[model samples]
Target: MDWIEANFTDQAGLAALLLAALGPDGDDGSHDRSHLLRVWQNATSIAGREADCDRAVLTAAVILHDCVAVEKDSPLRSQASRLAASRARAILAGLGWEAPRIDAAAHAIEAHSFSAGIAAETLEARILQDADRLDAIGAIGIARCFYVAGRMGSGLYDPADPPAGRRDLDDRRFALDHFGAKLFRVAGNFQTEAGQALADARTRTMRRFVQALLDEIEGKSE
Candidate 1:
């Protein structure tokens, strides 16, 4: 329990430090503090039931998961995971966490992102992965889809050009293509039953939303 408290306390401190460094406005204009908070909440909910999971490691991963996001200047460009691990390692070491736990927490944080191409190897990483993926599917997920799509200059739907091959995705494809590509796969990838259920329900909603959007765009909505 003491370790958990210390890890979380250090996590909060790091979050504050990173937020200050990123400024109150955030890097992506869209990824505000509230968004990070939601990811943390979702991760915590999933982490709570995993008895084999370490609370300190999971909590630290959740809070500092996006510390280095897609923002920031060059030299530091696209180095969120590296920067996060460095900072998190310092915090963990300061709290007397041995090398293994610090390494585990850093791995979880680094692997939490789908774009990172790193798979979750630990129980804590699996839980964090599911929780983070859950955030990309629900009502909030819908919002995030458009937010990210807009950022990437992607359209909402492309009726003529369907997402056929798995390997041909580029920046201009429709937002719905993401579901077929990866979002729907999350339900089966979750580590916990609760996380699986949440992913299933959210995936369904996302599918329905995509269908509705397609229908509306095609003037075929009922």
Candidate 2:
């Protein structure tokens, strides 16, 4: 089977084009161009290590994965991936991409979302899933959690139940509960070995932060 990398397409140009189309007009400090670039970087790294994965498909998927961003808690969040997939197909077609490549990229985009509940059937889809999910963990992910929390008017922690032991989990009200709710579960779902390795390391960093925060609240810090 022939891989798309053999065609020597101009990925950098496609990346710039996609970013221009997806990037915000103003600096909102949300998941913008930088986020797409990081996911692209992560996808490329994962693709480099995997066999029979279509680099072109992964690149296109990564660039256009978040083209249609919905709020995390929005009811339409699960549909974001499917909508992005449709948009990506049109974008790739306009850029002269062939049908096979466009379809592969679209499938990858459709399968990358956690809320969408789509299993990755292709290697490109798997890598894209891992790369996107990777952005939701680690130090940057922690910062992003707090960023969303702040934006949504959520407190840093629940004063009465800091560790959330006695209360039901509510990430919407307490930013720290996000770790237990979603971020900690991400590392286990990575598809590629490279992604898993990165996710594991990032998860460890997150765990340490959570522990440190707990200890600080308990006055156990040295």
Candidate 3:
């Protein structure tokens, strides 16, 4: 079965806006279809533990969270979520969704962005933010770190000081620097209790990986 069929039991409610939800297909793997799928999976697991979540609202928010494409270094990066939220409202309105539900989805989409620096007011908004942050840590997060680095033409790490001891942390130049720049700090940003727990564990995994990667870079065994 395809991902939607396997991960989600029923999608009858979302079928109408499914295409619009996918947004403009982008070449950025970090924010691609698989990313949306993973976020949905994360949101589902978290939502099951949280109280009174609206599945359709959460699903719509998850799918369209990244509708507006913005690069990591783009001048418009901080506004990406707002742009996507605006677009999401329009898309759902076209689907003839009620005002309240569309507003819920829009809030979730906008607040999900770390760059936006906005608080997630509702349960779905908090869940979406946490769910998206979940994908930015752990084993998968490690892979994406280097993947994005390669795309940005940044090195894996500083050759002389892998820990970035002397010089300032420059993630734009070194992928490893990102752990300090953002990854290590995201655990505390999780909103829901379940999401915070999962984030703590994933952040631990990332810590271990970072130490090991540094050890390998320094040619230290064990």
Candidate 4:
């Protein structure tokens, strides 16, 4: 919370973005606030090691990237980032931001999505992409994965085919399948060296978790 002012140059602009993205009051008591804080921290840490970046723009992108939350099971899931981007553009414009910086923030917000498949062209965009994906692995990622799965009414895993040994993966139906479907392969796409190192470490944690989960599923763990 204190880092909000410490990390970026323009406290007022950053605060406006937060209000626009997170609502006027901020963090209506959900995991959204925690997730935003983690991504912001990740972005700043990566930016600190890098040569050049617009901290204010990066902060705006981080806050508003998920401004439009589409449920994981929604048919419009793939468009979530694009929708957020469109909204971000308008929000930045309303805040009287210049054209170029607004575009930069909007692009970073949109390109950060895994399903969007848009390459991150700018340093800020790459950092944002890496930072956001960093949150999708490791221990916190495991917790969120199962939490969303439960919300979606998915089982832990198919008991008879825990690893999808016989059938293909269906993350929508089984929580563990999500690890293989996306989380396991996330590290290879990290854009920055710093992000890559953290991603690799987190990925190892996820793999160990999957193994442990499989062991429990088979009653192989003591």
TM-score per candidate: 0.77, 0.92, 0.91, 0.89
lDDT of each: 0.70, 0.85, 0.87, 0.84
Candidate 1 lDDT over residue span 98-177, tens digit each: 88888998999877766566878898888888888888787787887778788777886665655434356443467777
112-219 in candidate 2: lDDT tens per residue? 999899989999999999998888899888888999898788999999999899998899999999999889987788888899999999999999999998999989
Reference-based lDDT, residue 188, model 1: 63
CA shift of 120, model 1, Å: 2.0
Clashes by residue pair, model 4: none
Lowest summed lDDT window (length 10), candidate 4: 22-31
What does each candidate score in C-alpha RMSD?
A: 4.2, 2.4, 4.3, 3.9
Which candidate number maximizes lDDT?
3
lDDT of 3: 0.87
| Clash count, one per candidate | 1, 0, 0, 0
Ranking by lDDT: 3, 2, 4, 1
Candidate 2 yields a Cα-based lDDT of 0.85
Which has the better lDDT: candidate 1, or candidate 3? 3
Residue pairs whose backbone atoms clash in candidate 3: none
